[model samples]
Target: MATQQSTGSTLTRAWANTALPTLGAILAVALWWLVTVALHIDPFFVPSPADVLDAFMRDPGFMMNETWVTFSRVLIGFGIAVAGGLLIAVLLAASWTVERMTMPLLAAINAVPKVALAPLLLVWMGFGNSPKIVMVVLVSFFPVIVSTMAGLTSTPADLRELGRSLSASWWQTFVKVRLPWALPQIFVGIKVATPLAIIGAVIGEVVSPDHGLGSVIVGSGSSADTPLAFAALVLLAITGVVLFYLIVAIERLLVPWAAAIAS
Candidate 1:
């Protein structure tokens, strides 16, 4: 009976988790359709769902291709940011002098508007993928660094003492204890950065307008094809959502304790 009750509870929680969001999305779409109909909005300005669907269906292959382009850029940039950020965070945590010397400079650089830098990036990188990838790294880097430093520096005093008691070397202690503790917080930063990486890719694409969903949106806007623009936007939204959830799924698999705590 206890086992059955436990299984039933787990199923109930899973249903609630999945069903509520799906229901919410349905209601939001219904509301959007109603608003378009009631307001008698111009399809050229703000398209109805059916109009957007038609636009998507008109050039499904092109839309998918652009999406893939944008996603690939995001993946590359995000990967670099994660690797670089974690390395920097480790160095900063290991040395107070390094953290003090570099933190302010990093903050200043991060303060510069990414959009403003896009044009300069084009000049320097010459309309290549480099600028887009760099933009993604810039946008996504800080969160990871901050979260990782927080995690590493905030390792419990008891844990540190325990490591010392075990006569562990600094490297051994960090690898065996500190890094594991930091994993959850590192995942937190990754989840936060994932969407920003996509935004950075889109911004780069918008500036260049060479290819990607951002370029598609730019082209649609130029032609005043609101439905097509909306379709591109829908694709971008789906991509961001899927990527974010993919990261979350990874976090759950790799850091199950964090997921349990969060739940």
Candidate 2:
């Protein structure tokens, strides 16, 4: 009975925590609807929620397919960015000289506007997934590299010395001490980069693609289908939120101690 009661209480608290945000979202939408209706705003200029919903419902299949295409690009690009970033970070961490030599160049490259490069990438890679995936990697890679480097290098000198004193091999010491210590910071980078990956994919689609939400948005805009454009925007926002929360959920599962400490 006690265990069941405890579980019930926990669930109650979780729902309570989320309730205010849910209410706020509903209230905001209601306000939007009321204002649009009261002002007799043109749907072409500023679509009401109902208008957007109706537009989305008119052809849900097409919208869903575009959404799926964009989402798949986000996932593939994000996965590659994470893997490549971690590998590069590890290599940088292995030698201060190499880090000093390459980091400035990387920073310079990252500082350039990725959008400006999209057309070039499209030209080089052609109008397929390659350019989109590359854009996602370019946008998402820097944060992971910076965060992972910070985490790996932040291990205490005393701990590293202790490992050396124990005659631990370099690889063994890194595996046993540095890697676990770095996981939390690495996750922070992953979370930060995930949304950027989506943005990058969208940019790629905008520059070069026949399908995907970005293309749909462009087409809707060109046709003055504001409600359809708004609908696509809503889907993009939902996609970003969903991806971000998924990363958070994974972080909680993989690094429970980090999550606990954060709480």
Candidate 3:
């Protein structure tokens, strides 16, 4: 009986969470439609919700193809950023001296407006996916490195002492205690980087304007097809939301305790 009640409670909470956000989105969309209809806005300037829908339905295949191009670039770039960032974070956490020497340089590089590099990347890498992927990496890499290092270095004193009392070596202590503790923080970083990855991909696409959703947006705007441009923007927004939720889902699976503790 207790187990059944607990399951029911979980389901209730899940439904509430999902239902609330869905309701809010519906309300927002309704408001948007109402405003567009009442304001007599020009479709070429600010398209109504129906106009955007019509544009999307007009050439869904083309839109989906462009979406795939952008999505692939984001995935490739984000994947590389995750792998490389974690490795570099581990290396830095292993040595204070190395971190001190390297972090400043990384910060300096990160501080440079990433958008400025897009043109240079295009000039060097040409009109290909390589520059877009690299742009995503550059944008998303810093958060992971910073967050992972914080988690790794912030392992509880008690845990470290327990490891030492067990006669555990440095490797054993890090692998068993520090890494597990750091998983939550590492995931936080990854979540933060997700949107940045999308921004980077779009920026790269904007600079080249040859393929991807960004190119569609550019072409539409030039042709004064505001509804089509809005469609691209809507697609990009949906893509970002999906990617972020996917990361959250992975984080819940891997570090369920983090959520429990926070709540």
Candidate 4:
């Protein structure tokens, strides 16, 4: 009975969290519809909800193709970013000296906006997927490295003491104590990085890409097709939301205890 009630409570809370946002979005759409339909606003400036939906419906195949192109780039870039981040994170965790030396440089690089490098990257790396992948790696790496280091470094004092009493070697201490403790923090970085990776992909497309939501957006904006532009924006939003929830799901599966604690 208690278990049943607890499950019901969880469901209720989840529904409550989701319901308000859904309603709010519906209300916003309704308001947009009213403003576009009643106020006689220019369609190019403020497209009606129908116009955007029509654009989406009209070009389903094109959207899919562009989505595929963008998705491919995002996945490739995101993959390299994750791999490189993990390597650097491990290296930093292994050596404080390396961490210190790299910290200032990393900070400086992160401070410098990466989008500014796009044109130069295009020039050097050409208009191929290479520059886009490299941009995503550059954008996504810092957060992953920083988050992972934070997580890997956050071993519980009690666990460290226990490991010391057991005369555990450094490897044993990390494997037995620190790594588990760090997963939540590492996932925190992933949650941050996922959207950034998506954005990085879109931005890369903006500078130069044959197809993608960003290119769709750029194309529409040039022709003053607000409805199509909005459609691309909606798709981009969907992509980010989907990616975020997927990360959250993976985190829950991998760190059930931590997820439960948060809940």
Which residue segments of model 2 deviate by more than 4 Å? 1-8
Across 1-263, the per-residue lDDT of candidate 4 in tens digits comes to 54575677777878878998899889999999998889998878878999999988997999978887777787788878877887888888999999999978887998889999889889998886787778887788789888999998878788889999999999998887787888899889988998888888888888996678988989997888899999888888877787788888888898888955555
Predicted candidate 1 versus true structure: per-residue lDDT over 68-123, tens digit per residue: 99999999999999999999999999999999999999899889999999999999
Task: Output the worst ten-in-a-row residue range by lDDT, candidate 2.
Answer: 1-10
lDDT of 2: 0.92
Clashes of each: 0, 0, 0, 0
The model with the greater lDDT, 3 or 4, is: 3
Q: Give, for candidate 3, the lowest lDDT window spanning 10 residues.
A: 1-10
| Top model number, TM-score | 3
Find the number of clashing residue pairs for candidate 3: 0
lDDT of each: 0.92, 0.92, 0.93, 0.85
Q: Write model 3 residue lDDT over 94-120, tens digit each, in one string.
A: 999999999999999999999999999
For candidate 2, write residues 65-129 as lDDT tens digits: 99999999999999999999999999999999999999999899899999999999978989888
Ranking by TM-score: 3, 1, 2, 4
**What C-alpha RMSD separates each model from the true structure?**
2.2, 3.1, 2.3, 2.5
- TM-score against native, each model: 0.95, 0.93, 0.95, 0.90
Q: Better model by lDDT, 1 or 4?
A: 1
